[model samples]
Target: MSFDKIRDPRKIRHQIGDMECDYIYTAGVAGERFYIALRDEEKLLATRCEKCNITFMPPRLYCDNCFTELASFMEVPSKGVIESYTITYFDRDGQALPEPEILAFVKIDKTDGGLIHRIGEIKPESLKIGSKVTAVFEAKKERKGALTDIKYFKPA
Candidate 1:
């Protein structure tokens, strides 16, 4: 316990190991409903806050503006406009990807919020700001209750 008796503190033994975990998550009130719509109906849903008069994509349980509980769910259009974009050439591990991936912030028509998803079916250099795009969903039977249910957004 006394540092005075220690000669080389840096030489002390240290343990190294790997840890892994698995679990299920409840997507909360709004998210569960939104995801279910995508999986079962091939539709996108948003939460409209009555008090704040705002609609949120990938719906949240509460309004960011007025802090009101958002309960009304509405089907949002699959079509939107590209607000911004990027072509990523590297993966998360910093390795180069076989092909660059186009990603963008799509502003759904008439909605206050937008979804950030992959852009497909067009060259990266051809992608334009304010360009129209539509979500292409996976076949109904193949969809899991997740964002990937929509394979990608393509030119409308």
Candidate 2:
């Protein structure tokens, strides 16, 4: 290509197009059941692998350990231990938040999978790695089929 062709402003133009796709998302087998339990029953359900004797939170249809099809649904205690945590002071858009929010990875007892949620009603300095906590669900009538069903995890 010649330099004249490369430098021509008329040859260059910005093209814009909208990128969009729409679809209804159905939570797979395990998630659907778990969400229903949270919304209607106010219960935390876990799937246990009878063969390997492993329990999974958020109820998996298959076992990660033995790869067995998990069908045993059990209610696990809402109590958990904080595996890790962070205190965030800013919003996603880089604006300062009115107050810092404590986010944590809480590993519910006797289950493999854990929940990631906000920690409340406690000071940041008092938060510990193994702090005992429990899932706090929103009011029954206020619940929606989502992770926000449990508003936050607080000290047990």
Candidate 3:
């Protein structure tokens, strides 16, 4: 039986309901080490692909370009340049926030990849594409080996 041709909308049948399921997710080897460094040392880690000579922040286990195993890791500076940004007046739930938040994609120095994080400590009007920013980590006792370990990126 061939299912590719669908000419009539009335011929289609569907069910609409919530499908509930539970699952556990683990951050594999590369992610595990990356999060550990962020939580323990409040540092940024990047993986280098010797074959491609590319460094990826939020380190990966293999090179995206050549599929080479990325076994070399390096610590990159917590500072970066704002490559792009957005200002949102509402929260994720569509509720209005007291103040708009500025989110930006910060290109970490010396790495080919960057992280998307909230940009704080400045007004949205003052933000620019090339603005320098630094990661502001949560207090030592508050870190939990997650991206949230860095509360936000602030103007450097």
Query: What would the TM-score be for candidate 2 when compared with the true structure?
Result: 0.87
TM agreement with the true structure for every prediction:
0.86, 0.87, 0.87
Residues 20-103, model 3: lDDT tens digits:
999878999999999999999989999998779899898999998999888878999998999999999999899999999898
> Could you say which candidate leads in lDDT?
3
After aligning candidate 3 to the native by TM-score, how far in Å is the CA of 129 from where it should be? Answer: 0.8
The list of candidate 1 runs beyond 4 A from truth reads 1-12
Worst 10 residues of 1 by lDDT: 9-18
Ranking, TM-score, top scorer first: 2, 3, 1
Q: Between candidates 1 and 3, which one is better according to lDDT?
A: 3
How many backbone overlaps does candidate 3 show? Answer: 0
- How far off is model 2, as Cα RMSD? 3.8
Q: Evaluate candidate 1 by giving its C-alpha RMSD to the native, one decimal.
A: 4.5
* Candidate 3 residue spans exceeding 4 A from truth: 1-17
Q: Each candidate's lDDT (Cα)? A: 0.89, 0.89, 0.92
Q: Which sections of candidate 2 miss by over 4 Å?
A: 1-12
